[model samples]
Target: MSSADAFQQLVEETLLANAAVVALVNNRVYEAPPPKGARVFPDVTFGPADSDDADADCIDGVEHVLQLDVWAQDYGRLSSAKRIADAIRKALHRADLALPDPYALALIEVASIRAFQDPDGLTAHAVISVRSIIETET
Candidate 1:
């Protein structure tokens, strides 16, 4: 699998297996935002990702900047989304995680998190960014 694909898979698995995250989203973590009609609140979806080559000294690698969005609806607040975002951060930040056999995760960390209400008036969204470096296993 491509590095980005493997990275997402690693993240999705890590989130799904986390009790706190599962309790909040209940397997609602998706690689992409689900269709609008099928979306459930308090979910985490993979957002935009930027991957750039990190090759050096003949070693192949990638620096990946990825985002996970937390969705919730609490007309008066963003607390729920915030909580989910925290859980996601805890589950991933500085955590040692395994990738597919072809790849090795060199580092993973939470970059930043932002919470806000969508213009729709009822949707609260939290965006969590994660950065990681991955290298192919020889």
Candidate 2:
């Protein structure tokens, strides 16, 4: 699998295996936001998938920026969304992620996090940005 794919798999697996994340989202983690008809509140979804070369003098690597959207109902504040975001941050920030062969986690850290009321008016959304540098054997 491509490094990006392997990295993403590792991320999803990590989230799924995290007790706090699983409890917060009830394991409702998805690659992307599910259709409106398939809505499940208090869920997590991937924002996008992108990668760039992170080649050093002696090592070949890839840098991936992952965005996770944590969702909850906006009853007035972002309390629920914030809790979910915290859970995810604890799960991934500086995590010891294990990628498949040819892809090893060189660095993993959580970047910015934002919580807001979505345009839909009833949804509170938290956007968490996680950056990872994956060293590769090539």
Candidate 3:
């Protein structure tokens, strides 16, 4: 699989397997979907990947910059979204993700996290930036 697809799969699987995250979002994590219902609040959405070649003279690998967006509807506070974001960070940061036999995920790191109030004033949004290094199978 492409690095982006692999990275996204890793994130989705990780979040699904996290009890805290599942409790927060009601298991409503998606790759790309609009906010739908109360059960979907405190959800996570995966954004596109920005990948670059990290090949060396004797090694074949790729470095990917991935984005995960956390969303929640909370007035006067962003605690819900922040909590989900924190869980995501804890689950992914410095993680050694497993990929298909065709590829190896070497590392997953949290690059940055930024939270903001959406224009609606009731939607809490947080963008988490992550870096993943993958070694391709020979």
Candidate 4:
């Protein structure tokens, strides 16, 4: 399967399988449609924790960072963190995308997911983080 397609599938399956994520409380996963308007920040920078390797290149050329502005209408951080991480890990590992080393994969961070409620229903805005090395040749 294609990388994007695998990413979507991984998100769905991993979240569904999470034990902490109960069905009744937070069952559904909402995603923005294709060509999501948010700007993707490619070539994100990373540095070693304690090393001053300013010249060290942790990632190869054109590191990719895809930002999809998604709404989790029913789930909260307590139930979604593990699932989200799993989804990212699985998707990044899929053959379609460059295979990132398992050790290199890390949870960068997650922004505060605020509850967004309206007449339609309730939702939350989340900024999911993922760390990956650009294994593909430039």
Candidate 5:
């Protein structure tokens, strides 16, 4: 698999393993939309990934900038969405993720987080930016 794909899988697995996150999203995490009300209040989505080379002479590595989005219909106060964002940060920040075979996750860091009310007014949205370093197995 590509480094980006491996890193993404690691992230999804980490979030799925977090009990607090599961309680909120109920594993309704995906790259695409799930059916409405298929799970719970807040759902997590993995957004786009931007990658660049972090390669060295002997080691081939990649740095990936990934986004995670949280959505909820909490109206005025987006407490639930905020909490879910926090959980995502906790799950990924400075984490040592494990990638699929032939790839190794060197590090993962939460770069930034932005939360805002969507134009629709009813949905609260949180976007999390994460950076990850992955190295190919020799």
Candidate 6:
């Protein structure tokens, strides 16, 4: 599996998990570097997945898999990685879904949360990977 594949899968899972949240918010938003208050965030985009990569199946014989890659712009400056993961989990659980086993989807792992000092000051980014397998009842 490549980074792009992993990233797309994570994206799909997150959307599914937070369908309700998305509907309520009216727009998608990522946590951005705070200058205290900024009405609009800078233009940011999630690049497309690599052309050659493809999605993968779950080891437990799951048919469908959903994966998500979430990150803040200024990574590794502030914020706790675990807290970010918890936030992602909460977002997912709110829609009545749960993340799958980590071992099943091994792509971009949440190694750590770090802070970077920009010219403006210090900023934080929380990169997270989440997955959910589509299980069938036998």
User: What is the per-residue lDDT of model 3 for residues 13-98, given as tens digits with 9 covering 90 to 100?
Assistant: 99899887887886778877764543457678887679998887777999999888998888837887788889889888997669
> Where does candidate 4 have its weakest 10-residue lDDT segment?
43-52
Task: Write one digit per residue (lDDT tens) for candidate 1, span 74-95.
Answer: 8938999999999999999999
Global CA lDDT of candidate 5, please?
0.86
Question: Candidate 2: misplaced stretches above 4 Å?
Answer: none
Candidate 4, residue 67: Cα displacement in angstroms equals 7.4
User: What TM-score does prediction 2 earn?
Assistant: 0.94
Which tens-of-lDDT digit does each residue in 40-96 have in candidate 6?
A: 222111322223223345333232223233333334444433344455456643244
TM-score of each prediction: 0.92, 0.94, 0.91, 0.34, 0.90, 0.32
Please name the candidate that would achieve the greatest lDDT relative to the true structure.
1
Q: How close is candidate 6 to the true structure, as a TM-score?
A: 0.32
Better of 3 and 5 by lDDT: 5
Model 4: how far is 136 from its true place, Å?
4.8
* TM-score quality measure for candidate 1: 0.92
Lowest summed lDDT over 10 consecutive residues: which window, candidate 5?
Answer: 33-42
Worst 10 residues of 1 by lDDT: 31-40
All-Cα superposition RMSD per candidate: 1.5, 1.2, 1.8, 10.7, 1.8, 9.2
Candidate 5 C-alpha lDDT tens digits along 1-138: 788887888888889999888888888788777676565557888898899989988988889999999988878467888999998888889976677778878889999999999998889999999998888876
lDDT of 1: 0.91
Error (Å) of candidate 2 at residue 111 is: 0.9
Leading candidate by TM-score: 2
| Residues 35-98 of candidate 4: C-alpha lDDT, one tens digit per residue | 5454221111111111111123653322233343334434333234334433434433332332
